[model samples]
Target: MFFQTEFTHVIELFQLPFMQRALLGGILTGIMGGVLGSFTILRQLSFFCDALGHSALLGISLGYLLGLNPSLVLLPFAVIFALAVSYLLEHTRLWTDALLNIIYSSSLAIAIIILSFVGQYKGGLNNLLFGDILAVQQLDLVLSSLLLIVCTIYIGMTLRTQMLLTVDESLAIARGVSVSTQRTVFIVLLSLVVGISIKSIGVLLVSAFVVIPACAARLMSRTFTHYVLLSAGLGALSAVLGMVSSAWFNLPSGPSIVATQLAIFLTAMVIPRLRSVTHSPSTLPPQV
Candidate 1:
């Protein structure tokens, strides 16, 4: 009786219009994060994604100053930032970590300074910083759906080339892949994903949203295709579960989603060890 009542309550909660929007938004964000995150993990560009998220604040501030929607500015700003970083990595002698740190700190500082100049901005910066998924609206859903479709088509067509480039740039070049172009395109797409995701997952948790599910999938997958699919699946699962849990428990949606991903990661970490222990030769011998 208790279980039946609880299940009905869960269904009723999801039937709310805001909850429905939040769920759809969360799913789109999760799938996008997972799909792009696989490449970031393989290319060791996770920090680059984080830097992009931080740098987006500058764009938001500029948007407010110019009386434009922040989302309108964010994608272009992120693309420019990504291209600059890619160019620097290719031509400069500085280490990747140092360059990213410099950009991340400088951009964030500049954004704060700009915001101060904006003076009494009524925009909810907290939503940008920490996220408020429950605040998702119809336009957000429409934009997210379009972005997801575009990203999916791009990834589907370039998956093989991207995989080869990720594995070995020289080999990819030998096979006639344009290493520079592929990397640039990938960086731009990643920037777009990170930019869109900031609204739902927040700047603070975007990296975790993108990275954690891929990491968890890595532990469970034995092949590249499997890894990608499982990562996306896990991401979608976590988002749904997190949103439901948030609605039921009155928790912050972004943090709840991240917490769910963390739990999956820990479970992925432990399951293999548990399996090994359970199937060990010592245990088999004892049984014999």
Candidate 2:
């Protein structure tokens, strides 16, 4: 009994190379997801991120068909598709939502077709769609790290402009913010985050990383900067905990991490309401 219990505990983590990689990948993924997700939620672009994720599936298929690296091929493709979508939305009379749906559905179908043709490999589609964080390579790790640094620095330096644009684009333009240029930059950065996270979170659940933590932060933070920071922190915590838990239970890391995030989101949603009820209105100062 003692040996069995010990073995179970040991297998959960601190025993496998794949487990380490998954944990590291999750941390990086969370950072990037949290940073981009704040803008994603604030700008009402969660749908856009989902579209980008689906569109990236096309790139993944092309990679498998051509025997190239999926991450490399998917990165440029995601950026291109995101740019195309954003451009079409702004420059043409097309309905942005409809256009996004078209791109999303088409890309996903194409990927499924291509994957069917590719047939079997060791956990191919499973890794792409649901993710196998334990199988993350050094190349993918390096790529994610670089993208995370670039995004953090870029967004930090342009915080004011991003916040302004998120709240009211026309007003931001009136205040001398270049709407067109800023919008383009924002879309490109967002796409990069999605691309980088593809391996860690997979196509199906990547948007959860972007949406859940930001929603949690919304409950906890009052200022924009604090909200971003809080979201990032939550993301990191979830990544670490999920990775460890997955390894221990021999579960899928991507889903485990996302489950952790969902738990946080639920807690955030509930706590505020509970506080409102428990706190006394009579003791609190009256609102202006």
Q: For each candidate, what TM-score against the reference?
A: 0.94, 0.90
lDDT of 2 at 157: 95
Model 2 segments beyond 4 Å from truth? 1-12, 120-123, 281-288
User: How does model 2 score by TM-score?
Assistant: 0.90
Say which candidate scores most in TM-score.
Answer: 1
Task: List model 1 lDDT by residue over 1-288, tens digit each.
Answer: 987777788799899999999999999989988888888898999998999889888888899888898889988988998898889888999999999999999988988888888876636667878878888889889988998898789888888987898789999999999988888888988888888888888877888878999999999999998898888888899999999888777789999999999999999999999999988777444644
Task: Tell me how many residue pairs clash in candidate 2.
Answer: 1
The 0-to-1 C-alpha lDDT of every candidate, in the order given, reads 0.88, 0.84
| CA shift of 64, model 1, Å | 0.8
